[model samples]
Target: MTTALLPPATDADLAVLREQLGRPARGVVGIAARCVCGNPTVVATSPRLPDGTPFPTFYYLTHPAATAAMSVLEADHVMRELADALAEDEDLQAAYLRAHESYLADRAAYGEVPEIEGISAGGMPTRVKCLHALAGHALAAGPGVNPIGDLALARSSWSPRRCVCAQPGAAG
Candidate 1:
């Protein structure tokens, strides 16, 4: 049997990743990225200090769909469309806000809500799930993990690389 070896990290690679991170979200309203399975992952990109070392870090978010979707430009388009829809339709935005507010209220009342972290400013379910998955993956991967780290490693920005939902058509 043969085991696949993981690639080593490099400074040049980190630099390229940082450049990609610098780009602004092109009209992405509510976006999330997650591993197919459902592990919270983070992507970070920062310049190295005088010592020429990268300062990569990762954080937790609550949107698996957005997170996972971000992997592909096509999925990103879906997020963009959702954002445009929200911007154009006040009723839609209001509905999303109401749902999110209700979710938050319920959480506050219950003192615990399952998978509540993924929900962002709007009540986007896939995006929220992706964020939560990313956070969970970051915790499991380690504190040093971040957006840059994930990009450098070519791992999913939202969730663990080996997700159960990581099927070909799993992403939305």
Candidate 2:
């Protein structure tokens, strides 16, 4: 029997992802929701292309089973909503929604699910950073400082990882 090659999760790999997310990294900022399996799960929004298009989105990166089971569209829909909620400006929100719709249309025309890669949040991943950046920019554009922690979802199991590379007080 051939053995399947599974990507190994290592402490170093986690460190790299954490560094990419910046020092005080908020684990995965998930929206509280119920999975198709009826189990509660967190939905983390991944980044889009440079052109501001939402691509293959990952759900709970902590749970491989959920991530593997998520359909592209399902992930996209959740990401769209999360992004919209997190977006500081109307333009960004509109852009995210349009991109999502365009992706759906393209998927229907192609008759296959699109491949969403580089969407995992094993550490503080790039996608999460980008979302954080977007949220930050939006908050900066306004009068009141919309703190990242304010929008952060609080759940019993939701605990931000304290990365080895992280400075003291950086762990969110």
Candidate 3:
């Protein structure tokens, strides 16, 4: 992974992604976010995969701890709470809509896929569907860009500022 926003994916980076995902990573355009140890935390993927599948998730969370944290949040029904917050907060709704647009713009830079047009991951601009997607976007775009994502990350057990990559079977 390079310093550029969306550097070209390298073979070494792909290998780490494969390990994190437990499968070969598809449509990965670049490493979007990295752990303190420089391992990939989130990936920027192509709008359309190599298999011709329409992939809508541009920022895909890959870090084992981060993914697990988001899964735990989802399991705890945090999405419902977040959804309630979004419903009540007009400012949150506006920011989420902007995040949705930002996500769309990021994906559009890769290529166009009619099947996923106007669709951003994690139920943006309306609902909280997947914390993993929202957290991934937050990690990739940084704080404040995605309010829902920021909130999700805040509630999660994981912290991007720390390095859990040294854990057993995890990247370091």
* TM-score leader: 3
In model 3, which regions exceed 4 Å deviation? 1-5
What tens digits encode model 3's per-residue C-alpha lDDT throughout 142-164?
Answer: 89889999999999999998999
Q: Residue 141 in candidate 1 has what lDDT?
A: 40
Ranking by lDDT: 3, 1, 2
lDDT of 1 by residue, 15-62 (tens): 322333443312111112334443223232111223444321112233
**Tens-place lDDT digits, model 2, residues 1-172:** 1112213323543443354344422322323223233222232333343454553433223222222223332344533544445465664444444433332332233223345432222112211233322232222222122222113222112222212223342221
State in Å the error of residue 100, model 1: 1.7
Using all chains and alpha carbons, the TM-scores for the candidates as numbered come to: 0.28, 0.20, 0.95
Better of 1 and 2 by lDDT: 1
Q: Once model 1 is optimally superposed onto the true structure by TM-score, how far is the C-alpha of residue 151 displaced, in angstroms?
A: 26
Clash counts for the predictions, in order: 40, 1, 0
Q: Considering TM-score, which of the candidate structures 1 and 2 is the better prediction for this target? A: 1
**Model 2 compared with the native: what TM-score?**
0.20
- Point out the higher-scoring one by TM-score: 1 or 3: 3
The RMSD of every model to the true structure, in order and in angstroms, is 14.9, 16.1, 2.4
